[model samples]
Target chain A: MDKLNEILLNYADVDEIPDSASFRKDLGLSSFDTACLITEIRTVMGISLEPADFIKCKTVGALKDYLNTK
Target chain B: MIEKILPDGSKVTAFPISIPQQFMFFMSAQYGAKYPVNNIGLCCFIHGGADLEILRDALYEAISRCDTMRLRFTPDEKYKILQYITPETEMNIDIIDMSDIPLEEAKLKLQSISREDIPTYNCEIHKISLIRFKGNTDGIFMRLHHFAMDAYSTGVFLRDASEIYLHKTKGTAYPKPMRPYLPVLLQELQYINSPQQTEDKDYWFRSLSEADEPVFTDYMLDNRLTQQQKKNPSQRFADIHSGSPEAGTLIFSMSEDESKRILSVCEEKQLSVCAFLSMGLRTALSVFNNNETDVSFKMIVNRRGTVAEKKSGGIRINYFPMRSIIPGDMKFADAVNEISLIQNDIYGHCSLSFWDMLIERHKSMPSDAKPDSTYDSIGLSYQPPTEHIQLGSSPDEVIWFNNGASMIPLYLTIKHRTTDGGFDFIFEYRKDPDPVYDLNIFFTKLRGALLAGAEDPDITAHVLLKQLKITDEERKGKNNG
Candidate 1:
C-alpha cells in the first residue's frame, strides 16, 4: 500500500483504500478526519497542503497524483 | 518523576503534568475541589442495534489497546500532578439497564450517573458505563477528567471503540492501533524548552501586549452585564466576569440546511469554519458594544499539529486571546480573512504554554490593578469533526450532560452534528442567570449576520449590526411573513 493509503487505513476501518475512493463520499471521512489526514500527510509524506487544497481533490487518485507531482 | 515498588507488589511510575493539566489544577483550586472543575460529563445514546456482550468485549479490547484509557493522576509531595498509566486490566466498566424506568426518569438517572466527578487529588481518572435507555438503545455515559482527555480525544476513544466493536461483530480484523501515548507526552515535555517555545512566547507576548484592555461584550440580548453593573456599584467586576465557577449549559442547534449553507460559503472562500464563526462572534461583540472596533476573546488552540498528537488522547489546549481590532470600514469577508490569517499564524506556534505566558503577563501588571479577565470571560472553542461512532439512526441525537461546574464565565463551543453535519452551538455560562431567552436571541443575530455576510462578503460589519439590532418582535414578524 502507498503511504497515503497507509495513513487512511489508520482512520478508516477498511483494509485497503482504492485510488477512486473519495474521502467523504466513499471512505466516509468527516471534515475533521480530512483535517487530521492533512496533518498526517504533512508529517509522514513531507507534503504541505491546506485543508482547502485537500477538499479540492475529489478522490484519492487525485490526491495521490497531486502529492506525486509535488 | 519517580518510580517505586508498592508494598502490594505493584510498580508505579510518574510523569510530570502538562501545561493544560497545570491549568486544570489552577482552576480546580480556585473553584474548590468539591466542584471537580476538570470533570466533563458526556452522555451519548447509540441508536443502532449493538450487542451488549459484544460492546463489553470491545470496550475491554479498546481499553487494553489505547494507552489514554490507562492514564491516572496521582500527586506526590514533589509534584501537584504526576500521571502514570495503569494496567488495562484495572479498568472497571458498569453496565446499567434503566429501561425499566420512564424515559424522563431514565434520563435523569443517566444524568446522575454521568455527573460523578473524579476526586480532586486521586488517580481515579474516569467512569465509563454501558447504559440501556428507555428505547432499548444503548447509551455510553462517560465522566472524564479534562486532564486525561479532551473533546477531540473523546471522539478518538469512541471511534476506536466502535471500530473494535465492528471488527468483533463482523468477524473482521482489528483496526490499526493508535500511536503510543508516552512518546507524545515526552515530545510535549521537550517542547517546553525548545526554540519553537521561545518563538511562540515572543509571538503571544507581542500579540497580547499590542491590544488595549478590551471592554466586556455581553452576548445576552437583555444587556445583563449592563443591568447587573447598574444594580451593584461595587460588584461591577461581576459585569465583566462570573464570581462563581458553577456553569449551566444552553445548547442551540442550527438546521442542517443552514449549516450546509455556511459550510458551502466557507469552502467557496477557502476559509475554515472556525475563522468564519470567529468573525461572526467578533462582529456581534462589536455590535453589542456600540460597534466597539477593538474586540478580543480567548480562542482555544488545540496543539495537535502533528499526527501523533492528533491521534492520541490527552489535553493539549492553549487558550489565548484572539485579539482583533477590526477597522470600522472593513468588509465582513475581509474581516474573516484577517481572522483566518491570525488563526493560522497562532496555530503554527500553539505548542507553547499560553497559561504560563498568561501568568507571566499577570506578574508584569501593576500591584493595585486587578488582573483583567475580560478576554477569558467570553471564549469560543471550535471543535474539528473527528471520526464518529453511531449508536442511533442519526448520530446527532447525542445528549451532553453538564459537569455542574465551569472555569469560565461565557464559553461557546461550536460542534458539528454527526447526523447531517449541522452546527451545534453549546453555551456554558455562569450559574447565576438563565440566559436561554437571550442566548437564543444572540444566536439568531449571529446566524443572521453570518448568513448575510456569506451571501455578500463585501458587506461591511457596520451593516451587519443592523441584524443584531433587529427587534425580536420584528424578527418574528419577518419570519411569520
Candidate 2:
C-alpha cells in the first residue's frame, strides 16, 4: 500500500517483499527495473532521488528508510 | 566482424540478425530488397489536435527508450547479416503541414513514401512525419522496417509515446523505459540449435506427420485453381505458384453492438472468437471445394509470453500451417471446439522454426515445385487491442496503414478496433483480377456464416454454408468478368 511498494508492484512479479529480501537476487530486479523504479518514485511519490541513492539502499527496508528520510 | 562510422560519427558495431530478421531478409531477397515488403506503417490521427513540439519530444523519448526503433542494418552477406543500433544517430522526424490539402490527398502523399524501401544497408531503417491533415485533425505517420519491429511492438511504441505525451501535458506518471531488445534477441537466437530446438522440432514434425498432405484450398475460390486443374489433371492441388506482391486491402467492420453480440455468443458457447472465425473461413473453403474436408492456412503467432518478451520491442512472429478437417455433419459449435484444440497444440510448440518444418515436408518434392505452390494461399492473425488510451485522441481517430505489398495471396487480420472494441476484418491481398471478385463473394459468405453460426451453435457447417452460398442475386449483380 505504501508508495514504494505500489511502484515496486508494477516491476516486481512477487507478491510480498520482505524488508530483508535482496533487490537483485530475490526479486531479480535488473538495472533497467531499478531505473524504472526511480522514475516511478519521482512521479508517483513526488520525490527526487539519484542512482547512488539506490546504491546506498540494499534491501526493501533500507530503500524505505532512505525515501522516508527525504 | 565489420565496423563502420555512421554520419553521426557513432561507431556502428554489428550484431547478428535474429531469426525473425532472417525471415524478413529471405522475403525481401525475392524483390532484391527494393520493394518495401518489410515496412509497417501507422498513422494516428489525433482528434482535436496535438502540439508538434510536445509530440516530437515525446517521440524522441519513446524512440530513445525503445532501442529497436533506432536500428540500422548492414547488407546481407552470404554467411552473415548484421544490424546495429547507432547510439548517437537519431530519427529525423519532420512536421509536415498538409493542412491546405484535402485529407485524402494528404494521405496519398504519405502512402507513396511508405511504399518505398528505407535503404536498409548502412542506413536508418525507419521514418516518421508529424502531419497536419487540415485544421485540428493532425496525426503522426511512422514507417518502420519489419526487421526491427513487429505489429505488437508498434503498439508498445505508440502506447509509450502517447503516455509520455500525457505526462508532459497532464502530469501523469513518467513512462517506464522499454526493456532492451538485444537480450530478447540473444535468447531467441540461441533457439536455433539448442536442446529445446530439437524437442520443438520433434513436436512439430510429429504433429504434422499425417500420411496425407493438407490440400491447399484457395480462399480466392475464384476458380483460378479450378482452371489450373482442368489444364493439369495430374496436379496434386491448387497451383498458386505465381502471385504478385502488389497489394490491396478490403476491410469489413463489425459495429460495436454487433461485435458485442457475437462476443457474447462466443462466450456463451465457450468458443474463442479466433476459433469461430477459423471455422467460418475453413467451412467456406470446404464448401467451395465441393465439401472437401481438409483445409489449411498459415497462422502467424506473435511470441510474447514473458514480461521481458512483452516489454522488448522487436519482431517475434513465427508462422506455420494450421490444418483442420470438418466433416459435413459436424456442428458449427463443435467445429469451433475442434479448431480450438488444434490451436492449443500449435501454440504449445509455435516457437519451432517454420522454415525447418517446410523443408522437412518439401525436401523430397519434385524439382519443379515452387515453394509457394506447396501449402497455403492465405495467412491469418488475430490482434486484441489492450493498449490503455492516452494522447487526448478519440479511438476512432487512430488509423493503421498497410505497407503496400504482400507476398501472400491474402493475409486476413482480424483486430479489435481500439476505438470501440469492434472487429475489423482487414484482408490484405495481392492486386490480381480474380482475387477482387472472389474475395467480394468470400467475405459476404464468411460474414453471414460466422454470424449465423454464432447465433445458432447447433447448425451443422453443411447447413450454414448451404445458406451462405453465393446467392444468384450476387452472381448476377456485380460478378465482374
Q: Which stretches of candidate 1 lie over 4 Å from their true place?
A: A1-70, B5-9, B120-123, B211-213, B221-239, B360-368, B391-396, B470-481
| Candidate 2 wrong stretches, greater than 4 Å | A1-70, B1-13, B76-78, B231-234, B363-368, B476-480
Query: How does each model score on TM-score?
Result: 0.84, 0.83
Worst 10 residues of 1 chain A by lDDT: A28-37
Model 1, position B119: C-alpha lDDT score: 71
Global lDDT of model 1? 0.72
**Residue pairs of candidate 2 with colliding backbone atoms:** none
i-RMS for every candidate (Å) is 5.1, 14.4
Candidate 2 lDDT tens digits, B334-376: 8887887677666656667768877755654446557656657
Q: Write the per-residue lDDT of candidate 2 for residues A1-69, one digit (tens) a residue.
A: 376776776666556778887676576554334555675687788888776567467788888888888
lDDT per residue for candidate 1 within B117-164, as digits (tens), equals 567444557778888877657777778778788888877777788888
TM-score of 2: 0.83
